[model samples]
Target: MEYLIPFNRPFLTGKENEFVNEVFRTRNLSGNGPFTKKSQAFFENRFGFGKCLLTTSCTDALEMAAILIDIKPGDEVIVPSYTFVSSANPFILRGAKIVFIDSKNNHPSLDENQIESLITKKTKAIVVVHYAGTACNMELVMSIAAKYKLYVIEDAAQAIANNYSFSDKSKKFLGSFGHLATFSFHETKNISSGEGGLLVINDKTLVERAEIIWEKGTNRNAFFKGIVDKYNWVDVGSSFLPSELIAALLYSQLQSLDEIQKKRIAIWNQYKNGLKEWALLNDVEISYIPEYSGNNAHIFYLIFNTSEKRDNLILKLKNKGILSVFHYLSLHKSPYYKDKHDGRELVNSDRYSDCLLRLPLFVDLTEKEVTHIINIIVN
Candidate 1:
């Protein structure tokens, strides 16, 4: 029997060990250390983001975004039903009502065209997740938000370093367009720090408050910069920062972003080429990359003709030693949210939940392994 090929695995290159060793030598493993500052600076400079705050996980960043926005009970936040629960969980935790929207027919992002119809007087914000590292139509979403005076929070968990281009040839990095954005550095992502994430604040007005909330409602960030003589609790908040050890690991990953991305893109292209014939013959559809968007090849998922075929394919792939998987179950259909659903049917989201399957994609997957996996699927 062959060795088991895991679904997703982290890849480390460059200075991970050296940086981590440096952290240990310094004896300062807590947050807001030298590495943390360096990592934050790296994000701001490379991604053209206004500000960046490293956190324990993408969930923590989203929670921070929720608190920064002051989400209140009865306030509604529009989000896609096709994303991980963490995307919507923060708003729910804040007692804000969730308005689940469907995805576009060809992609796993919130259908921007359907957004306007869902907006109401109670809608305070719109959360757009860049599913599988493919960006949503930010221009349209931003336009709608501006017209309705709503805030836009980007759940960019899977979109670190992903770039998007517009029809007019203009381009923007995924995390730069939103009022606030969140990124993940979990082991499952392209980058890994065991468990970590970052929050990017594009709205200058929210920067100071975000830092306060990040430091457990204290103006310690200010105090540290000599702007304040002392720090004390000034608002309701929590500790969202990660230790310098995690920052050290992430910095290593960030330093090699280009090389890691190149390898992943190669694997993504191999899968597409290898599966094209099988997909066509089976009447299935593969993922599409819009001309206006440059994806990071973060994930490669295919859509089968029916839910039954998708399930059978998973079993077949597993039997053949290829471990493929499905994605999020629509949030609106979950027991926790069923009663809360606003009676709107998210048809596209349901379709995605039923039919999509993610193939093995990661930085370290060898060409021969990829070929073997593709052969199993194609056969």
Candidate 2:
């Protein structure tokens, strides 16, 4: 048998070792160092975000966003049922009621058309996850948010370097549109820092509070910058920042973002092309990338005709020494949220939970490996 191909893996290139060695030489491995500052600056300058903070993980970033928004008990936050649990867990931890919405047909993102009906008097925010680096209908989501006067938090975990273009010639990065957005540099993401993430703040009002929360409720960030005489407890918060070492690793990935993105896109396209005929024959659906969106090709998934077929495909792949996987069991149906679920059936979300299968697509995967994986699926 061939070497088992895993679903996704991180690739280290360029300055990974160089930066890590620099951090070691400097002996400043704690939060907020030269690498952290450089990483924050890179994101702010390249993505046009108001501010960026490197966090321990995307989960921490979401929690920071929840803290900034003051998600009190009974506050309702609308989110897609098809996303990772971290997207909604932060709000839940803060005592907010999660209003889970279904995905749109043919896509893993929340249905913008359905968002309005789910909003009630308690709706404080809308959490939109850019599933697989593809953009959601932000225009519709933004309009609904404006009408309701709610905060929009983007879970752009898979969307680093991805952009959404508008007809008016304006282009916005995935993390740029939301009041606050979170990104992951987990080992599985396009960029990796072993286990790291970032929080991008787009709203000026939230920046100061966000920093305080990021620094464990203290005004330490201000003190460090000489903006304050001493740092002390100012509000409720947690330790959200990662060590300088992680930032150093991520800075290396950021330097080669363009090259990584190009290679990933090529792999994604190869899968799409290889499976096109099989998909058509089986009446299955392939992931769609809208023209207005620039995807990072962070993931490549296919939807089978039925849940049974999806399961069989997984078994087949595993037997063949290929480790394909499924993503996101609908949060509404999970044990934690089932009792709290709103009395609505998430049709599209359920469909996605049952039918989607992610193939092996990684930065280090070779053309031959991709062809082999696709051949297994097609056959």
- Name every residue pair that clashes in candidate 2: none
Q: How accurate is candidate 2 locally (lDDT)?
A: 0.92
lDDT of 2 by residue, 46-135 (tens): 989989999999999999999899999999999999999999999999999999998988798998899999899999999999999999
Model 1 regions more than 4 Å off = 1-3
lDDT of 1: 0.92
Report the C-alpha displacement of residue 11, candidate 1, in angstroms: 0.9
Give all TM-scores, in the order shown: 0.98, 0.98
Clashing pairs in 1: none
Q: List the candidate 2 regions with Cα displacement exceeding 4 Å.
A: 1-3
lDDT of each: 0.92, 0.92
